[model samples]
Target: MSNEVVLRGRIVTGSMDIADGVIAADAGRVTYSGPASEYRGKAGPATDNILLPGLVDLHCHGANGSDFSDGSADGARSAARYLHSRGTTTLLASLVTGSPANLVRNLSVLRTLTAEGLIAGSHLEGPFLAAGQCGAHDPSLLLEPDPALVTELLEAAGPSLASMTLAAELPGASGLVELLAPRGIIPSLGHTAAHTAAAAGFLEHAAAALSAPSNPTGRFRPTVTHLFNAMPALHHRSPGPVSASLSAARAGNAVVELIADGVHLAPETVKLVFDLVGAENIALVTDSMAATGLQDGAYQLGSLAVTVDHGVARVDSTGAIAGGTATLLDVVRTTVAAGVPLQDAVLSATAVPAAVLGLSSQAGDLRAGLPADVVVVGPGLTLAGVLRRGEWVAALAPTA
Candidate 1:
């Protein structure tokens, strides 16, 4: 059968590009795009939906009754299906810090999934993080980066090792940054108790790599994760590492992740983050747990038990907000409801995250030659339909 499939709707793509149209895809990639009238071949029936690029969530701990922290194949598979409904075409199974052996097991499971196309790769979000500022992560498991351990992980994960999270506050972190820099394993800054000077030092590492004398990698500083959710809150006078992170984004080198569910961040704070980092440098993430897409109830976050009351998940034992129960789609809707421009809100979920992971030129765009992954939103700005690999996954039309 031909890989080509044609979809018709209001095509909303890029940060500032939106068109009333139809988009054609072949061999799991977009081949042509233009006004709906321009599509002469068979077209999926039009609806009030707005076609968009599939979302890329680069920082999620888990979802749909699964926590990637556990590294369970069943959990990862369950999470993947849950995310599919919310328009996520690509995702990283973000694992929290744990025993060394435990992490290896998780990596083994993910490598298998990657071979099966259920996941893109692994994003290790702990061990190298600062224990002092550890958010929902288990403090006992956090540690400074050990080069040998990093190598072990790479081997365990094999070709599926995509990225890892680090805190600039830790000593030797810059060296750790150097170690991963050449391996295509992106080093992101997160859960750091680093001050402004320390954060800037990390920026220099990324900036030096992207320099041209006149233009620098200031725009490509390693990513700053869950911007205001973990580490430290932005203080006007202190600014802290979080502030430095926003500053780097202005130069265009870094992308910031935000849990846009209105609980992890205030609607006002969400607006403030966009004001500081622009839509192109922001990636809207759900940071959800297994509770997401399901009713609010009890769930597991690794070894820690969690409770979800009113859609907010908290570690049952410590009462700390464990993770979110909202999917990436809910986050986009929440941003729009909070008054973020629809265009920027869309980019945060799609292009920005892909760019941060260095997958932009390939996975993030809705333009021709981009992957056939696409989604359609309704006039209400809610998820109305979805397209994955040039095929319809869901649609708001009378028939899918």
Candidate 2:
């Protein structure tokens, strides 16, 4: 008896869409993915469902009322499991700005989860952000790029540290990039008050440092963390980090993350980014926190207090956007509703972020020899089922 899973639908293979396609997997590896007519194996019964690779999120904080920054192993596990069931098969557990001791503690906890394969890796969204544009992060916990502290955090995270977000305008920011890039840890620029020139210069420096032969990571291009948020707004004269990031993305030098959860940005802004940078340069991320998948209520993001009302999360005192309360799948639905082509939105949510984490071969697309991590959706793009490593994880009746 052979254990094989086969599905037939309209397949979004990351590169193109096949109107009538078949995907076959056995023992957790995709054996074939292409036109149904070409598949040699017995394909499943045809349906109107859409098949896509599982999503990869580069910046998700938490979900299911569990916070990764809370420094609890159980909380981290619960969050990862919840996200995995929701179609995000690969993700980096993100931590917000916190005391050095707390940050190190959280990293230590997440390192274990990474080793267990619950998450792809970890992303430190900061302790190195610009105070002026800290957004929901506690300003009192923000810090300049100190070498000793960076070294300590790196040592604590070990090989599981995938990326760190820092302000480019801060003194010694370049040095931080130099240190992080060569170690295979991506240096993502975010939460800055820098004008165009400074931001552009830093991007150039980062690209150079990452391209060096000495660098070991597959991430050669830097990423802009949740672009246009926690950074200065773009202006005709001022231009800011947002302008610099857009230029870099257009030039194929950087990947910009977009929180297309409908709350973090306007629908027009999501469409504008796809038009300007193309889906290949965009990574759709869910900068979600503890409130995700739960009802509106008070929650904690790092050390700050947050409240979610009407699906929007904000810091209680400052009213700044805290994070997101949507899953990566929800982001894809929102992006499609914003007028972006379905193929483009799916590519950004899947392949682009997988490439950023150096998991292109392992996760990303519906290609032969890759893990059979797939999502099946019905009409209007509503999710119907999820298969991770060839095992059915979430299966719901298809909607009409």
Candidate 3:
């Protein structure tokens, strides 16, 4: 039986674009990806669809009525499967602030999923956050950077722990960075009330520690979790984490994640970040929750009750904007609509996040020798098909 398959279309990748391209895959790997004329093998019928690398979302909570923070293996699997079918071939299951026991339990469940290759890894976005800036998270559940608890969480997640979001201004945050950097876990800064100097100091310290020669793990870089959200806004006199994060990103010392779903930030804000820091240092993510693919209704993010009205999720008690209701592809579309170049938006949603998870070699680009994970979309960027490891996961008629 022949395992080879070829797709021809207008191919767009992180670095290049081909008007008439052919991608050949066999044995679940891309064998060739280049101009159609350059492909010597059997070529499939050409189409007007656009071929893109399967998106990599670094921050995602859930979809399809399943929240990753629920500590339900079955529910997490449902979310991962639903997201994969929607063109996000890889994603980290993100969890919100919760009690120590609950977080450990959730990490345990998510570890199983990561080990099973259902998700990239676990992203802990709570506990070590700033209470003053805890947007949708329960403020009472937020904690300082406790080394003991951090160690316990790391052990609970094992090697599947990819990132942890913390308030850099916390007293022991630098120590936490040292602990995480040596073990390959990214120390992401978020949910903070840190001023410009404090945030800049932490970012510099983290960058230095992660890139230090003493670190056993390969060079890792810190990331800013959903930059501009759950943090103090930038002001001329009192610039906060937003300014520090943007500065770090523009200097190539860190990557900043942006929701870009139109709910978390304005279109002008999205474009402004792109203009300031470029796409290479930005990651477009979907901080989606349980109501992502469902109708407007009530949902749960950890222990908090959320209501989704007009596709926007918000906390019922505090009325703070909750997680997003968009997929990574939808985020890409929104970013593109925000005046960001399509290639740049796609790169941020794909390669930038893949690098954050240390999966650049395995995923995140359309190139030879990588997994044949690709998304087929129409000229308007509507998803028409999705292929994960060369197997069709979702197929629909291309737009005419």
Candidate 4:
């Protein structure tokens, strides 16, 4: 007999949804996914719930009182476990700005964890950032894009460095974009005060960089990191990066990430972005930090002191919004509750992020032949269970 498990519920993938459906997994891949009535083989077990592809978070700092920049393997594992328990099967452990040496040390630590499957990859949130917009990161550590520094960090991270967030307007920014484009590492533009014209210029330059002959896969695509946060606000005359990012995404030239945790962006703004850019261009990320999944209190985000109160985390010295306190799952719930359709919201949390990381084929959907990472949730969107690679995660065991 074949080893298999069958999940029955309101099946939802990144693209579509089926009511009263069945998804079967065997040998760690989804063998079948369709209406239950159409499944001819033996059905394993069934539950009436919402079944979705396990979420993918493109930008996540830390969770469970563990910051990815803490330079400890155990701390990284704790954060990974917390994310996995919340149905985020794919996560990039994000590091904040620090000295070059500290960044390398932290990336080395996460590199080992990535090899051990604790994380999918690593995201360098900066050292190459605009000091004027360095929100939670220490502005003192911010530096201009230096090719040597970028190369060193990438070498230390090995293949585990999947993404980096930088300011598009800074001197030599386009050169950094060119360097990252052919490497399959996503070049995310953020923490900047770039105006609309400059943002668009960098987007075009980034696009051209990926078109080089050296890049065979042609998978390089730029992204807007945590759209709106850490960037200048959109104004009628002085339209900033937000407009440029939205326009790029609308034209299928870029992918934009939104925190959408109600703390990072207003509920109406979240809905408007969904309406304008649609789900395919938008990815929902938590940008969560050490304060996530913990009660309101003092916390640390990289080298800066942070305080979380009323579930919002902010930097202590500057009172800037540090990061988010919600998981990717919680972000999905918040987006859906804010009037975005559930299917669209789920796609932003799953397919969009996976696409941004160039991992859509292996993750981001519930189709046959894909990895059997799935999430089961109650009618109210409460996570009840999680499965990673066809194996049940005991941490999210369903509750009665």
Candidate 3 weakest lDDT stretch, 10 residues: 391-400
Candidate numbers, best lDDT first, in rank order: 2, 3, 4, 1
Model 3 per-residue lDDT at 129: 88
Query: How much does candidate 2 score in TM-score?
Result: 0.97
Tens digits of lDDT, candidate 4, 34-90: 988889886555666999999999899998888999898998888898889899999
For every model shown, what is its TM-score relative to the native structure? 0.91, 0.97, 0.97, 0.96
Model 2 ranges off by over 4 Å: 394-400
Candidate 4 weakest ten by summed lDDT: 391-400
lDDT of 2 by residue, 1-400 (tens): 5679999999985697999999899999899999999998878678999999999999999988888999999989988988888889899999999999999999999999999989999999999999999998999999989989999998899999999998999999999998998887888999998889999888888888888787666878889999999998999889989999999999999999999999889999999999999999999999989888888888999889999999999999899999999989999999999999999999999999998888898899999999999989896778888889999885321111
What digit string (tens of lDDT, one per residue) describes model 1 on residues 222-312? 6776876667766777778887888888777677778999899899888888887788878888777777777777788766778889988
| Candidate 3 per-residue C-alpha lDDT over 1-400 given as tens digits, one digit per residue, 9 for 90 to 100 | 7688788999998888999999888889999999999999878778898999999998999998989999899999889988998999999999999999999999999999999988989999988888888999998888878999988998899988888898988889999999887777888999999988889888888877787666554437789999999998888899899999999999999999999999899999999999999999999999999988788988899999999999999999999999999989999999999999999998998888887777888889988999999999999999888889889885321111
Query: Cα lDDT of all candidates, in order?
Result: 0.76, 0.91, 0.90, 0.88
Off by over 4 Å in 1: 42-46, 207-221, 394-400
Candidate 3 stretches greater than 4 Å from native: 212-219, 394-400
